[model samples]
Target chain A: MSPETTVTFHTPSTLDEAFALLKEHGDDARVIAGGTALVVMMKQSLVVVDHLVSLASIPGLVGIDVREGAVHIGALTRHRDVETSPIVREHLPFLSDVYGRVATVRIRNSATVGGGLAHADPSQDPPAALMVLDARVRLVSPRGEREVAVAEMFRDYYETVLRSDELIAEVIVPIPSATARTAYLKFLPRNEDDYATVAVAALAEVANGTVQKLRVTLIAAGPTPVRAEAVEAALEGQSPTAEAIRAAADLVADAVDPMDDFRGAPDYKRDMAVVFTRRALERVLLAQG
Target chain B: MQLNVNGRTLEAEATGLATLVDVLRYELDLTGTKEACGVGVCGACTVLLDGRMVASCITLAAQAQGAQIQTIEGLGDRELLDPLQESFITDGGFQCGICTPGQLMAAKALLEHNPQPTEDEIKHWMMGNLCRCTGYYQIIESVANAANAARGDR
Candidate 1:
């Protein structure tokens, strides 16, 4: 089934107008920012909506600013902009690289940061990258506004904790500490544009030859972006040695619950998750900070 | 809806769900943009939206309402050819020619953004525009040679 022939597209110039349309249409209205994900879902009949509330005309929802010790990216900022933004490149080059790894230049030109996070596709790269950076998503509704950690945003496949009346306003990614080493390894053995079989993002810092801080996150290996807490628990405060890293990486095999697809079988994905996670950790943990 | 395509403004009677590819090919009769993978993976349906390359298959007609849409027809005509088009013919950038339009448009975008691209940059930027003929070497050469010719380095 395709979209109904008489779907109404509404371009709201203000967040208040968008909220009103969403509230009026209820389940039939979807907030479309870039249309990279929602349009495909509509084409595939996975989601059917009668009204499309586009945020394209909204002002003040598109910019990249560095302030308050974090980079505040507006909800409507496109992926290509984020990938090439000088502010992002300087403060968070690892994140810039991660954003650049998304589908292709064409897709990146149209996909947006807020839309990507709001879509909440578990296989996407940004969620894991943002999780490793300790990013927070700023949400707004007619009632009030709040912030949710990137790791806690996802509930399941294509599902988020966003309420029906709520909309994502911005994504605040606190710049990683200068001494930290971050790595994003996407295990896409097939097409460069394809999603990863298992993607890993890790940020680590070593002080006086011991692991001071470590954050491990993985995508495409579970329903949501999986944070390897057990691995972190085992490695934090421990010496950054090859044997210890291997032991900690092996814990990812039990942490992830990957689904079988053309990319790989469940067991194969689990194995690749461990392998990629270990490589990513080694790149950050064992490297000189 | 009003669409500005190839420097001409036209009216299209389409729904918000109608894709830009469908509008260009059916409503406005611009068939140069093809849709191979309707899910936005393939580059067959690529077009320039406001001077930037985008997947027309996944982009809605409503999305291109106020943007300048450029198709292969706008690149060059029979009277004259764009540098990239001439390079494709002189450099053997096509075999079956289904992916040629997309290849040219994607290359055109790259050249516009970066006038002189290295071999690695050419490959990296054009990797998404797949050619089923497996003539990647010729395609990459076409883009590189086009850039050089544009800069009078040939």
Candidate 2:
């Protein structure tokens, strides 16, 4: 669209209506929740669509509630709400902090959690936190609905496994264990609002000075949020110590494959990934102690 | 599309893909809300859609259908300026002034939800509203001064 392309806009009040609209239009239709990322892409002519199916009219899809030990955040819930919600603050304060750090208050007020996740930008702050929390994204289509782990959501840079007809409906974050300690550290070498050069999210359960459980994740260090499985493998049953943490974090250097960009070179990002992972794990371990 | 802008219901014809900033600037002629960065990074296009400050440059005009839109023009009339507007003028919160409208709106949203914001809150809220001229201390002080004035400390 050199000048501008006028597309048909569809406001579907119900999920079924939205599904039908998407089904009819297929790949030609695009679903927009807050339109923060999609609108920028559309303006840049990165994503051109003939039909825009807006989910703004859909009710019962913008509330955050606690259900069966999980925080059920409607896909349309604005980031501001998530950052300020008492329910989220009480149940998942780490998630609240993560959302609060995205962009600034103005952008967060309009950007939805579902929109952010579907945008699938690895540098975004939420994915690393969600991965550590084992969050799941609820996707709906004309065919059916299914839940996919947020960690498994992104396939590559600016890509996800979501089908064209499927719309992200909600994000389900399982409440962390009472004894679990979590930390999300975003390393921003540039300005505050800029995306992280390398971010880390770590959750661990330490009992009797031993590592009972651990989950370490990183963002903007690779094509997707890299789950540092090797890091976890090194310290799963070992004692928690400065030396052990460093050794385990070193494994992150192997797991990430970040592309060279303005943020940092691929090798630089890999190195910083290890540094951030160690720091994140140290914070969580200290909290456990 | 129908929009309730500045407490007035206005009717305008806009494309489905047209952003709210363009609709406000070109169609409605509400150029007070400037558009510096078409992307959402800069808050030059910030406006309150239903009491929440949003990047209107990235917001679709159609998404704003039935929502209450408030720009800097809506915040104050020609005769009486809003407290933030007054504070901005008094404290010299802006230099070139492209970011002033967005800064005012963001500050307005902050004070609405949080009547008494700490310096950190003001900074966090207004971080998106970048200024190329001022060093940001003046903007922070302006918001703080507005908050203090609103709190009857003036």
The candidate maximizing TM-score is 1
lDDT, residue A24, candidate 2: 89
- Residue pairs whose backbone atoms clash in candidate 1: none
Assess chain B of each prediction and give its TM-score.
Answer: 0.97, 0.97
The RMSD (Cα, Å) of candidate 1 is 1.2
Kindly list the per-residue Cα lDDT of model 1 for residues A207-259, writing each as its tens digit: 89889999999999999899999999899999989999999999999999999
List candidate 2 segments past 4 Å from native: A1-3, A287-289
- For model 1 chain B, where is the 10-residue window of minimal lDDT? B126-135
Model 2 chain B weakest lDDT span, ten residues long: B120-129
Candidate 2 backbone collisions, by pair = none
iRMS for model 1? 1.8
